[model samples]
Target: MAHKAEDRTYDVIVVGGGPSGFVAAIAAAREGARTLLVERYGFLGGMPTSAALGPISPFYFDDEQVIQGIPHEFVQRMVADGGSTGHIRCTNPHGSGSYLCFYDREAYKWAALSMILEAGVTPLFHSFVSGVRVEGDRVTGVSVTNKSGTSFYSASVVVDATGDGDVATLAGAEYVVGREADGAVQPSTMMFDMAGVDTAAVKAYMDDNLDDFEWASEMVAVHPYSERLPRQHFVGQGFKRLVKEGMDAGELHLGRDSVLFLTTCHPGVLHFNSTRIQNVDGTSAESLTAGEIEGRRQVMSLSRYLIARFPGFENAQLIATGVQIGIRESRHILGEYTLTADDVMSGRKQEDVVARGYFPVDIHNVDGVEGYGEGGVWAGLDDSYDIPYRCLVPARLDGLVIAGRAISASHEAHGSFRTQGGVMAIGQASGTAAALAALGGVAPRRLDVAELQAALLRQKASLRRDPERAREERRRAVQAVSAALAEGRISAKYLADAGTFTGQAPRL
Candidate 1:
């Protein structure tokens, strides 16, 4: 049963109101394109708001700030609401200077909404993108269903940011699902919020049990059942192994255990973005439904555990659950170039690099993989890499650009580049490229790289091509550290500390 089509048209249409769609709508409209953003939810902020993820992680690139433009502005506004810190060297047991901030999720949502409205972008909420309208090899419009019924909204260009590549898939774009070799997709998380907690007591527990409570490992074993799950472990040999190296180097803080990514938010209130729901497929409605059901069960159990285990949480209550299941990986539309694990490891910079992602390849397991157990697979490069423009341009699509978790990249690369900060960078690029394509009457895949760079520059993006300045800073840091070692003023501990401090070696 279909209703009458509205046939309302705009210059651009962005589907999904997550990080990518929010930025895409703003970017296109700011460039003078009449844009419409449709979201199934009433409010925006995607995962951060919907999931109640109070903290935003990995906001810096190396020792310097990387993500700028709209995303930075959004974060800065939130930081202003609280007391936001800036540009510190992140290196410790769990990488202290990674520049993650504990924020107000509601405030973030309001800020994102304000930015979109100010850009003069029309946002239609409670409307889901049901079908895409295409003519021949190009996408011309999309059909969205709401309380009114199924209505078509035409557009000159479309950017897919549904995280699962929903719009592009519906629009006839071909894509790949999961991994190729081992059939591994990144694990999904179900975050929750707790109120009536004591910040001091929880922080003390974290310090005392830093090694025994391993949330990632324990959750992988006991989830999909239990309303009273076991407590998360933080104090153990595994955590010790991670901290000993960094603490010894002097490059890291002595109490490096304080920041080992345990599921400990502020004391009185806590956000549980820990439970790893594995083997869930984002594309299938059935699979996603199963994940959601299992996720809620695990969350309830975990919440009960928090009440019983810690001192401050005796009165703690589960106040909120994620509005939507947090998906880590999904259907990726095959693009002009496939980003490989090698590109990320080597920190390769491409001439057509559109956005930069510095987060590590934080892969969770699928099926019966080892995970970060006693001797787990924990390998990552201590640098950021550039995502080329070709990765966002679908191989066969003319009017579509892919952003967020579904951008064309290997499963390994996707794990690293799928954070909120990284997604914003991709969204900015996609929106800018779409606007450029519409103006030039050219395919998004064929836009000139130099011209795009100029536009990005005018927008104050951080992709300056001064290879010499970057090289010189590394050289100076190395030279200074070498001198201290030669003078015997520093021990083997000192040399190791210097390497880690300069970001040459792993934090721990």
Candidate 2:
């Protein structure tokens, strides 16, 4: 294929069409910037679509809908399309926040595409960004390759929403990979879905065998397994005894010791986030290939073990696996300000806050240590923390901003903001800033923070905590739950839980 240069120029060109990239492009275009979105895959939704990861997390914090704007609107659209359960209170012990949004991946793709196109974003799918076009310290454009050939697309500002920080790395930006101590990144997983599940049998088994779940005592303290199991969406992380038995019987061999699954909008179908492949660097092609192969192998063994030993899986069939292995941790770009663990732990506020992170510091075991069920280390937060605009401005690179999991944050802090909801908020901020910078003929680093914040507010993005709004949201949630109970969309068993529910609106 011959290299070619495109004549058209864009005000903002976003790389990688994941959650962040998808929203970044839309935000830029809606801001009246000539934005172009480049994606390797044919569709959007990033990790949720390509890696089969779902329910979007951390939509709520301290009983309030902290993350709104594009993310909230996206879920509302999905709910209206009958592809999501809307925002429901999370029952899982290791969940990010009080509420999570569960949706169908196919619906996610369609909704994302429709939204971006409606925003006037020019999307170039099935295209991979091969190189960064840099002039001195500033990036001017990117080299993209597709079926037609290699072409150059020039832009005044670039949003690196590639989850791995690919564009920033290529642009000579400083970065750190993995944990600071051992340089080992988090393990990757191959997410899969199974159909024909006997959910009723599974719920009964959970009701009967509380001791099987390591966190059952903590979960039951709030809502019993029976009460939580019958909702429109469900998440479970248990079956420790059965997992041990399978491993002892030489039937299962995976890094995790428990079964982690989430219920989708479809009946009798469950999404599995169980296959764990350790010591794989997502930035390396060779490592990703090996991880994918090992992940599929684990999926096969785990699926077999589940059908043979688990209560509801006796007649279940594996319906689909992720298109790619889910990469939890990757390269973290060094920016003007590196978000620290203390910042996240203390719910630190900043004068230039652009987004709020509500998810807990959830670091999956990099080395697969024993006694860590599901190889997870969870640190909960009482409130959401601020993500400053400086975290998105690369310290050493010009005309570029980072988004998604690749933002400037310590390894521990990254664990929280790396989630879909947080990244989407970060993406919106970055795109809006980029558009403002381009239109004002200023660099991203020199752009005024107050102006950006004002733009976000005008767009209905939540920047600060509001007690009155929180109370209203809680009331709306309660009414939604009550409506669900009244309409019989959920089992009457959930009525007891609904009695305690004080949350947001019914599905949009």
Candidate 3:
């Protein structure tokens, strides 16, 4: 059932369709490139869709929303459709002003498809990039294979949005994998959602037994699940005591100290990101296969523990499981700039900055343990750090720019920039840069930063949202929410999402 090579050419060809790729193709086409987006699966939304990573993180930094442009618009649209929990702040003091938004992954797939089409980007699904035809350091063409056969696609520029940096690697782009100490990446996760639970009961237990729960920070009040009501959401926190009991009794097999869960658009349903399957490198086919099987077993075991022991889940129902195993870290290319941990920790502002990230340096323990030891994690700041334009340009590789979790950053820095919101911004930048490069027939390295910045601003991209002004905005919003609460017009959960503005944190 195989056919001969069919040739096609475009101004830009982007590989992957997850968080970054979804917007990268759209951004490229909007910039007037004849763009094509290729995906291994039938649907888009990448990791969030296939791997079920929910609650997009840190689109905001304290009071200011840092990531803008097409990516912000996409989330705003999802909000209007009741598919998102918009801008819920993490109250933990140790947290990095992380903005959390729980979303419906199923709805996101359709939203991504619609946006890609509306932006005039062509999408090819159920296809994998099987080969790359490179001329020296530049990739001239890519070969993709599907059920029909092999097909070749030529593009003036290529964007590597693959979370693992796979395409760039094949194009002779040098990449580093895992942490510097050991050749091991972060652990993989397989997520699931549960239904038919008394979330109220769960909340009551948590609020009453604050001593029983282990928090990301002691600064965070034991606001229960119901505390996340009206705006109505939950996330990877709650009930460490129950998890410990399960582990001690041999009811649970995972090593994670805290539970990872989130809310959906659906009431009485919650997403769980608890299972940790370590030692799986996502780039390997065999590894992914084994990871999937192991992840599923963990899912079943964890599901059983929830129903049997957890307070909120006395009548819990296992609803759905992720289609693919979620890989946290993988191959990252050496770019013009290798973003360092010191750069991130010092809150370094770059002259040629492209995007800003406010998420914490959250490294899930590579050994599948609960917490970090000596060098595992760094909760550096609650402020924003800019990602430089140089980090997108792969060194010694022409016609290529990297996006998503695979962008050039140290293991610690990558933890922050790898957040979905950060990658989305990087994706938009990648697309715009690629389009400009293709139009002028120049390599990405030679493109002017000023022109790119102007283009991004015109598209409503946010390079900065002044902390003072943003803080004032937060004050006004929170005052309004406080007024509503004073009048007994809004519920506590509803107020939590709006007026409780922990406004613009000081610059680190």
* Candidate with maximal TM-score: 2
Enumerate clash totals for all models, in the order shown: 20, 6, 2
lDDT score, residue 23, model 3? 91
lDDT against true structure, model 3: 0.77
lDDT of 2 at 402: 87
lDDT of each: 0.67, 0.81, 0.77
Error of 3 at 423 (Å): 0.2
Q: What is candidate 2's local distance difference test score? A: 0.81
Q: Write the per-residue lDDT of candidate 2 for residues 205-258, one digit (tens) a residue.
A: 766775675442111111112232234455666788888888888888877888
> How large an RMSD does model 3 have?
4.5
Candidate 2: segments with Cα more than 4 A from true spot: 1-7, 91-96, 216-231, 369-375, 476-508
Clashing pairs in 3: 18-46, 236-261
Better of 2 and 3 by TM-score: 2
- For 1-508, candidate 3 gives per-residue lDDT tens digits of 3433443788999999988998989989999999999999999988888887767776766556778888888877776666665555554423223446667786688778989999999898999998888998888768899987888889999898889898888887888987878867888899888999876676566556656543332112111223233443334354778888888988887747667665566778878878888889899999999999999988898888889988889889998877799999998789999998878877788888888877778787786556544334747553688889999999988988888889987787888788888899999999999999998898989999989888888888888767686777466445544544455443353223442432332122
Taking all chains together, each candidate's TM-score versus the true structure is 0.80, 0.91, 0.90
Model 3 ranges off by over 4 Å: 1-7, 93-97, 216-230, 372-378, 480-508
lDDT by residue (1-508, candidate 1, tens digit) is 3333543777778888888889888888888888888899999878877766645665555434567787877767655654222222222313222445455567677878989999988888999888987788788888888998888888778888888888888877778876778656776767787888764576565455644444211111111112232222111122343334444654333211212233332345556554667778877789889988877876766567557654678888988887878877888788999888888877788899888877766665555323453322234555678889999898887788887888898887876777778899889888888778877778888899888877866776666434565455444434433443454433333121345434433333
TM-score of 1: 0.80
What local lDDT score does residue 261 receive in model 2, on the 0 to 100 scale? 77
